[model samples]
Each structure stands twice: as C-alpha cells, then as structure tokens.
Target: MKTFACALAALAIVASAPAAFAEDRSSARKAQDNGTRQIPVCRKNLGTVAIIEPDNQWWREFNLGSPEAILRVFVQQSRCFTLVNRGRSLQNSAMERALAEQGELQGGSNIGKGQIKAADYFLQPDIVSTNNNSGGGGIGGVLGGVGGLFGHGVGAIAGGLNIKKGEANVTLSIVNSRTTVEEALTEGYARKSDVSFGAGGGGFFGGTFGGVGGGGYQNTQIGQIIVLAYLDAYTKLVSQLGGLPENASAAAPPAK
Candidate 1:
C-alpha cells in the first residue's frame, strides 16, 4: 500500500510537469515582456498622451472592458509619452473637485480647477473587426467525405477534431490635441489557431496575464487575439513616429 501511494504521488507530479512548463511559455508571460514585439524608446519625451477607446462600445461584444487598460501599459513601457487620465479616473478627479467646491473637505485640500495637465496628444485604439473562426477547411465537408469510407461513427468521432483559427484587426491612431490633426495612423493584425477542445491551446492566459492586470483580456480567446493585434498596431505606431522601419526598434533621436 505504501509503495502504491508513493507511485501515485510521483505519477501526479510527472503528469503535471508539462502544464507547468507550458505555463512558463504562455502568452501572459510574453505579454509581460511585451510579447515578441520590441518597444522603441525615445530619447526625448513626445508629449502627454491620453488613451481613449471608441464610443461604439464594440468591446462589449467580446466582454472586454477597455482598450485603455492595455494601451496604457504599452505607452508607459515604451517611455515615449507622459500619460494623463481622461477616462474613468478623470471622473474620480472631477468628483473630488466637486467635494472641494462644496467645502465638504478640510482646508488646504488644494483640489481645484486648472490643475489638470493638458494632453498634448490623443492616442485612440479601435477594433476594426474580429473573426473568431477563420480560414477553416470545412470540417463538416471533410468529415462527410470520411463517413462515406470509414462509416458514420468513425466520422462523427473525427468530427470532434476541429482546427479553429481566430483573427483580429486593430488600429492605433495619434492626433495632435491642440491642432486636432492626425499625426499617425497604424493598423495591426494577429491570427491564432486552436487544434481543438482537448488539445489545450492559446499562448495567452496560461492561467492569467499575471501581474499587469489583463482584465477581460486574460479571460477570453478573442480578447487575447485582440491584445496581440493591438500590440502589433502600437509597435508600428511607435516605429513610424521614431522613423524606424516597421516593427523595428532603436533609440529615437531627440525631437528637433
């Protein structure tokens, strides 16, 4: 009995090894390192940027929160621009000012108007579209052909083996806040394939996006695809502004 128990424990550890290893190679880990994309660093600060999402609420379809969450991560990590709060956090700041105006706070609170930093540029993220299952070779049709030779039961079992591909098209744009001129517009795309339900796929969300807080981006398949797409777009945007080749990285020269 003792020997059997020890054997079971050893087997359990061995069985779990691959999963642990795979987790380490997961996309969440990659995202923390900014995935495969190299972030370009600017020697001179571009300007204060405010990240905003589209008004369409298209992300609601995928159960995602806001693109601002991840976009801000890229912006801050790139060290290109100062980020200003213009989203939900802005409302919080407004509430505080309202409180100060009501004299509901202590003296010298120093909460007042004109203290807000002006955004020199507006960085916006938009999801052009997403294809949850694309480029599939008609699983049903192949299975039907198989059924003619291998019988219905075998074909049905084989039907369970499906190859699914997901893709997303995302864009990032930067505009001069004062002049309201579009400075740069870049598009990014990412595609991923899943072997099937039993195979355990997707490099993203091995367990979670981990420390950086992925929000819904860590929880769903389409969300992960979108994250990669956006990362691609941001990469291009930075490279364009830095005058580097697309998807290339280098130290940006000081602003003239």
Candidate 2:
C-alpha cells in the first residue's frame, strides 16, 4: 500500500509538471506577441518627404548606416508619407534626358523629361549614446574573486561576468521644405545592460575571458538602445499624425 501511494504521488507530479510548463510557455508567447504588435498610428498620407543624414558627428563616426533606414522602414510600413529622393532626382532626371536624346541610336523611344516631385517636408534623425557604470560590488566582484583563486592568469574568465550598461537618445524632426520651419519633433530614449565576456590573452591555450567588450554598431548595448529609441520615436510620430483624434487632420502645415 505504501509503494502504491508513492507511485500515485509521482504520477500526479509528472502530470502537473506539464501543465505548469504549458502555462509558462503560454504566458511567454502572449508577452512576445504583445511586444511585436504594431500600433496603428498614421491615418492619412503626409505627402512626399525627403530624408537627410544625421548632422551629428557621433553618428557619422559610428559608421552605422544613418537612422534614415529606420525612419524609411517605419514610414513605408505605416504608409504615412510618400518618400522622395531629393539628392538623386536631379541627376536621375538629367540622365534620363540624355538617354532620351540618344534613343534613336539605342533603338528606344524618346522619353520626355520626367517631372520631379518637390518634397513637402524633410526628416532628420540624430542619436547619442553614453556609458553608465554601476560600480563593481555585485555578483561580478564575487565571481572575480572566485576566478582569482583559479589563478590571476585566468582571472579574466570571471571578470567577464562584470555588468555593463548604456543609454541612447534618439531624436527625429520634421521640417517644412518651403518654409524651413520645424513642424514636428519626436524623441526616444533607451537603456540597455549586458554582461561583459570575451576571449583574449596569451597563446591558443592561454586565452582568458574577462574585461569590458564592445559590440558592433547594431549588436552592442548602445546599438540595442538606439534601435529601441527609434522604435519609440516612430511610434510617437505615428500616434501624433494619426492615432489621436485631435491630431488626425493636423499632421501637415497648411500650404502657403
């Protein structure tokens, strides 16, 4: 009877374990879906917009493709505005005209000069990142001390457990092309934290993992923050342009 009771209890636990795991999985899926859902923000198109590279030197030095990529993707996906290539329009038009003039030689029809659509607004993106250190008194220090016992030569293995934090600020602005007046400004901020772990030192067998490591433009702590900030700014821009009732028809300035 005692053996039978134990078996029954074990079976009950096994059955309940699956249920608990399924509940946890369901919760995680729900959270993930919520985070990925797109918020509908733009209702009407805001006319043609020209994107300009960020003026910040930091952005240039970072060598990350301009935040224009983010804005372009967001605007295109939202159908908020018709994008225009201000820089290439003129050159493309001239080339087209030249091709038309030589159409006979190339056995092609003479195409008339293409009409260039003037941009109604220009968009600019700027980003700034800064590092934040929270001291070395946490589990990192404990781990480092433990690693030290293994030998100072391999101390980096434990040092890699150190925490790193960073913050990013992103700003997007819309300016009227005709009036050169700022129409809308949106800002987004993001904070990111991660553990520092890397392999370096000595020969093939002498490598140690420890110390602060930096990530590439889009993969590091700052990069993650930049991406988050852009998402936030884009969300706000869409909300202002289309989500709110009062701002539904107020997205663009009146034409002079």
Q: Whole-model Cα lDDT per candidate?
A: 0.59, 0.48
Q: Model 1, which residues run further than 4 Å from truth?
A: 1-37, 134-164, 193-208, 211-214, 243-256
Candidate 2 colliding pairs: 156-209
Candidate 2 regions with alpha-carbon error over 4 angstroms: 1-41, 87-93, 102-111, 132-164, 193-218, 242-256
The superposed Cα distance between candidate 2 and the true structure at residue 58, in angstroms, equals: 2.4
Best by TM-score: 1
TM-score of each: 0.63, 0.55
Cα lDDT tens digits for candidate 1, 25-72? 655454333232233445556678898776555665556777887787
Q: What tens digits encode model 2's per-residue C-alpha lDDT throughout 34-129?
A: 333332224456677888875333443333445665566556655667888766666786787777776733554545655566777788876433
